[model samples]
Target: MANIEQSASAFLQSRRSVPAKMLGLPVPDRAALMPLLTAGLRVPDHGKLEPWRLLVLEKAAMTRLAALAVTRAGELGLDAEKAVKGSAQFETGNLAVVVISSPKPSDKIPLSEQVYSAGAVCLSLLNAALAAGWGANWLSGWPSHDREFLARGLGLHDTETVAGIIHIGTAQNSPPDRPRPDVAARVEWVSA
Candidate 1:
């Protein structure tokens, strides 16, 4: 049917990313973001662990978070430029969703599988925002990788980590599309 074809095209065309700097907002509110987040929660879960969570960042918390980034970077001796860039995401973002990788302890489900599911959640969130006609970017800067930053800003538990930060907003500019990987190189045909 035409609908199936259209859906396929939309999925393919959706593989684009705009610069985080080029993003400004009118960020989606809780009421507005509910649908977008619900869509993301639909990602593939191997063991139904739902091993990820989202942290919504509103405009009010942006300044405090940015300042925390500055302080955490100093403590960690991270590059100043990188720290500033990391902070800028929160500083400028009108709203954001931090994808927290929270793996449930499971005997049957390996930890790696849960991690993969968290990663899938990130992609799903990114695409959902794009499909909804919002300018969205998924970022995980140095701060995300820093334990100090995670503790101070996100209060990430030992079982959890930052998978990605999905920044949603109105677009300041339409970014150019980058090239995609060749499918043939990345896939293999196996007849069972």
Candidate 2:
């Protein structure tokens, strides 16, 4: 048990996301991705209401979505820089998993909690891919938040929102380690 705990701690401490732009080919196929998806689904749920679903976007889908993002940006009269930033991920991505936050009508569980669970799934999926020796990153840009883009490109319902898009592929380069937060400054202990 101690060994298991120590291993988990070590993995968590060292886990870092590879940049989406740095990710390249040899993405995980459906067979290889299934286990990662399974691990992602093991997040906490207060009411057992699984308020999340995944949309796997392959190369073709990524291209289509990139076009849609550009079109949507045009319709919204966004600047060229914003439009480019919005579509860049899809344009270069070989494969991505869209974690959709599909909230259910529930009396007991709050909507915020359901949304949080979806976010947890996104992190879990990203971590699982990294652990499996794949480069992975979680991202959401203006395209993810635009209603028109979500409706047309992803077929998202009114109650559904983009939790995150986890891009997975072979890493083109290793990034230098960035500064981490000061844990002591962020933590507060309470004893009664």
Candidate 3:
């Protein structure tokens, strides 16, 4: 048990998100991704509501979404830079998993908690992919938050929104570790 705890701590400490552009081919196939998805599902759900669902996008789907992003950007009168940046992920992605937050009508569990669970699932999926020897990054841009884009491109219901889009693929290079937060400054202990 101690060994397991130590290993988990080590993994958590070292986990880093690879840049989406740095990810390449050799993405996980459905068979290979199933176990990772299973791992991702093991997150906190206070009401057992399972207020999250995954949508896997292959290369072709990504291409389609990329085009949609550009069109939506035009319709919205966004700047060229914003449009390019927003659509870049879909344009270059080989495989991605869209973690959708599907809030359920519940009296006990708050909607915020359900949304948090969806965010947790996104992290779990990204971590699972990294642990499985694939590079993974969680990303969300203007396109993700735009209602029109979500409705047309993803077929998301009014109650459903994207929690994250996790891009997974083989890594081109090992990214240098960026500075981490000062945990000591952020922590406050309370004992009563």
TM-score of each: 0.92, 0.97, 0.98
Cα lDDT tens digits, model 3, 133-158, are: 89999999999999989999999999
Of 2 and 3, the candidate ahead on lDDT is: 3
Q: What is the lDDT of residue 18 in candidate 1?
A: 67
lDDT of 1 by residue, 82-149 (tens): 78997898898888899999999899999898988889888888888888888888899888888877
Any idea what lDDT model 3 has? Answer: 0.96
Compared with the true structure, all predictions reach lDDT values of: 0.86, 0.95, 0.96
TM-score of 1: 0.92
lDDT of 1 at 32: 80
Expressed as tens digits, the lDDT of each residue in 31-62 for candidate 2 is 99999999989999889999999999999999
Report the number of backbone clashes for model 2.
0
In order of listing, the candidates' clash counts read 0, 0, 0
Q: Local error of candidate 2 at 15, Å?
A: 0.6
Error of 2 at 83 (Å): 0.6
lDDT over C-alpha atoms for residue 7 of model 2: 85
